[model samples]
Target chain A: MKYITTVNGQEYIIEIDQKTEITVNGERHGVDFQQLAESGTLSLLIDNRSLEAIVEEREDAWEVLLHGELYAVHVQDERAYRLAQARGKLSDASEAVVIRSPMPGLILDVLVEEGAHIGQGQTVVILESMKMENELRAGRDGVVTRVHVGKGDSVEKNQELIAIGDAEEIKEQQ
Target chain B: MDNLLIQKFDKVLIANRGEIAVRIQRACHKLGLQTIAVYSDADRNALHVRYADEAYNIGPPPATESYLVIDRLIDVAKKSGAEAVHPGYGFLAERADFAQACYDAGLVFIGPSPKAIAAMGDKQLARQTVRAAGVSVVPGTDPGLSDDELIAAAEKIGFPLLVKAAAGGGGKGMRPVHEAGSLSNALAGARREATAAFGDGTVYLEKMISDARHIEIQVLGDSQGNVIHLGERECSLQRRHQKVIEEAPSFVVDDELRRQMGEVAIAAARAVDYVNAGTVEFLVDRDKNFYFLEMNTRVQVEHPVTELVTGVDIVQEQLRVARGRRLRYLQDQVKLKGWAIECRINAEDPYHDFVPSTGTITAIGLPTGPGIRVDTGLYEGHTVTPYYDSMISKLICYGETRGEAVLRMRRALEEYRIMGVKTNIPFHQHMMESHRFLSGQFDTRFVEERFSMSEREIHDELEAAIFATLVAHQRSQRASQIVAPGERDTSNWKWYTRWERLQR
Candidate 1:
């Protein structure tokens, strides 16, 4: 079976066959993996080299600890993967993904207004929760099409606070 | 003669949770005292509770309703037949009222006297008291000043000063104003933060030492008033004024400076008639001149470094002092042995602005071997809740020299393994390899303003990627494996149906 694996925004085409034979991104690799009796522990031998990985299933993603750093991995099957690729294309064509609140908090301040162009990693909103200020930044560069919340507004986890879209849509809105 | 008799307690109740509580419990057990752990609703399954000889539920998850409730804690201690109460660092540890309550309940408070805690608990009052003891403070105004007066005081004290909340520490209610133009605004912001966090908006201004380091001396006193200092710990490596890393025998302090700071620390403790284990913190500037910051009237969180370097078990001394016994070592007998460094392992994601992460620890691989100690409240399958502080463990390493200590810390950090939650281990690893940190050239702003994790890209990228891809591939295979729908020939109903069809 052929699988599309996406890690940190990079996609790889992996083909797995019987007898521990696999090809990753068109490059063949002979890998054997054994799930140890201990949960979330994996022992892998890649091209006769031994490696260990600790994996945990978080709420919506998988957290893998390799070496001393942690990586969040998101995996989707073939059909879901295709749908995600189409969605990505659609978003790139016109609109941008909406920025949502990562946790429940009070919107202490909003840095930008609608119709304003924003670059990626620019602070759009400042949230104060648990007595700490959290700066919510834009994940991608786009023009602010709409602002859904204002200062002092309490927001729930994953609640949409701002919508970023292509320049044309923002200009139309303006 | 009054202190000649050693008072003993059969049972001591640890009124705090997390690693500190577990630490106190260990001390109590070593001294042949039974430990009782009091927990909030959220900490029912905490490691401290499991480590205690007995456990009791005090109240709900919020500290105000549970751990910070003095009456509730005292009631639990009494009901559990505990003879003493040990409030470890946070929560009610530094609260004078809690200590008084413990005293009123006829229980030994395994800390300083209530008088000392009350005197030093107020930041403004502490400044006045320490200055009265002939120790120079950071030149801050007195409390109860109007906003207009605060601005005027800031101008007089100079443009660069800090507006600090008079009631609390830990970066809460503290704001640094670089010029007169921003003093009023900074004061307002500081007041709001202080009020929200500590329930007191009263703030004072102090000269801001831009290039200063946080150095604190540990002091132990008995009822007989014999106080001795335990050298100094460099806690300058902080993020937003919260200490992240600490080491004993500060690279900044030599023997003469250490002696001066130690004398000042002893004076501060003497001013308040402090007893048991307390920490006198100072802000040392670039010129080696130190100013008294505040006195922490309880055993500090980073006491382990001092313990390792001085070969003095601070908790054990705190217990003994509470028992009215004289200190084990005099001022001259107190000696500094080796270098010790401690990295506070907090359950915070360093890459994501140090936000608190919570989950059940699925797998853990703690570092072991010589000269390394991991004081932790973490257990396999233990859950880290969001209702408390993010600190999960403290990894301390000791060595004959600073370079050796750093190397050992690097080794231990590499061996430290925790899953199911994010940590600042990567950041520590980055710091271990940092040139400035290795050279002992960093200040409080080193972490926030100077240090950047982006620079230290994981060197083992190729290895990590290979392992990750292999794991991912195997996971996908297991998930996609098609299981046989059913045992086709083992169904009784299907067998009877086939027989009937054959008969027909």
Candidate 2:
């Protein structure tokens, strides 16, 4: 069986040919792992090198902690990957940048107006949650097409607040 | 003669939460006194609440409704019969009114006199007070300085200064002006941000001391007019004005410099008539010219570094001072024996601009061994709500030399683990391995401008990929498999156990 894994914008083509053998990015390796317990601890032996990490499954991704750093890994089988590619849904942020509220909060301010060009890491919206004003920044640079939440409006977790598309699309709308 | 006959308080009501509260409880226990913990609705299962002799629910999770409510805190103290209240670092720690209320309620505040807190709390008044004692302060103009006046002041204070908002903190409304040409534009931008964030446009100009290290003196005072300094703590490693790493007996500061800074710190404490534990912060330039920054009226977050080196328990001294007793040590008795370092373990993603991360801590593996002390109010199942500061714990390591301490800290960082939330442990680990940090050549802006944690490559990426894929494959396989019932209901292991019993 073959699987496609994406991590930090890098993709890996993994093939599980044998029980204790696998190939990642065209490199074959002998790999075996045991789940220590329910605490997400994993003792892995890859190519006879013993290692340990804490791995947990989230809603849409597999989070792996190695050497005190976390890597959010997205994996899909070969067919699913091809299907996703056909549908143009590959978790790419530069295509259509959407700003979602990470937690429940009130929209303190909308710093950008519609049809405005915003840069990556720019504070597009200010959300006040738990009495702390957190600046929700844009994940990628794009032209804003819609402002979903207005100032002073309450928002829930994962609620989309703004959508930014390519510059050409905004020009057409204008 | 009977000043020590009556104890100040039999029970201490800790008017704080999290690790500091637990820290205070440990101190009170060492003194043979009871501890009363007050918690918000969100902190019911917190380690501090569980460790206290008695716990009380004050109010809701928000600080305005719970931790900062003076009346509610006092009510809990009174109901619990706690004769003294210890305000830990944040929350109501530095509130002079809270201390006054504690005094008015006939309770020992376990800190400085209310007048002292008020004087130091005011930035201008603190400058004036410390200046009267011949202590040099950072050159700056008064608050509400207009843009035109600021431009003029910038020339006097020289270039590479900071235009800071009077009512701003956490690096908001703060702009760095490298030259006079940008001072006006910087002022306008800072004013706008300040007005929007703090609702006040007041601004000030301070001469930014380049190549400066943040060294603070720890002073402990008793009600008997005796005060002594417990040496100095180097806290130059900061991110956005918040301390990330701290160590005692700064590498830059020698014995003579330590004594000089200690005297200045003691002088500032005397100026305010400060009682209990306080830290006098200073900005020491490259030329060894140290100027007083401000005084932290309460115990600081990095007090453990000093405690580990000087062999002094500051919290216990605070309790003793609250009891109207003399200080335990004299100035001559205080000594810095070895090096100690502390890393603040915050629940923030260092890779992603240090944004606050919140979730339940499903599992925690604390580091233990030689020269390690972990101060935290966390447990396995504790939920890290987004209602407060992101710092979940402090990992401190002690050693006879700075190199040894750094090595121990690196080892401890590798051993420590906290699941279900992001942390800056990797950042600390990277710093421990960095050449600049090991050589003590970095300044306050090192983290903000120079260092990069994400630039380094993860060595175990291949192994991680392999394990994750294997786990995912196993899970998918298990979900697809359908188990069939066997002829024997019990397993082979159960039959073997029964056979052993029959043989017996």
Give lDDT: candidate 1, residue A126.
Answer: 81
For model 1, state the Cα shift of residue A36 in Å.
2.1
lDDT per residue, candidate 1, B1-504, as tens digits? Answer: 644466568899998899999999999899999999998888888889988999999989866688878888888887889999988887777778888998899999999888888899877778888889899888778877999988777778996777878776667678778888888877887787666565678888888787899999999999888999999999999987779999998999999999999999999999988889988899999998889999988888899999999899999999988888889999999899989999999887798777666677889989998899999999888887655677899999999999989999999998888986789999999999999999999998899999988787765444444445455555444433322325443433344445547657
Question: List-wise, what DockQ does each model earn?
Answer: 0.39, 0.33
Off by over 4 Å in 2: A17-19, A23-32, A89-94, A128-133, A172-174, B2-6, B143-205, B483-504
Residue A89 C-alpha lDDT in model 2? 56
Query: The CA-based lDDT of model 1 is what?
Result: 0.82
- So what's the TM-score on candidate 2? 0.89
Stretches of candidate 1 exceeding 4 Å from the true structure: A1-6, A9-32, A47-49, A58-61, A74-87, A93-95, A104-126, A129-131, A140-159, B1-4, B180-185, B460-465, B479-504
TM-score of B-chain for each predicted structure, in order: 0.92, 0.89
Itemize residue pairs with steric clashes in candidate 2. Answer: none
**Against the hidden reference, what TM-scores do the models get?**
0.90, 0.89
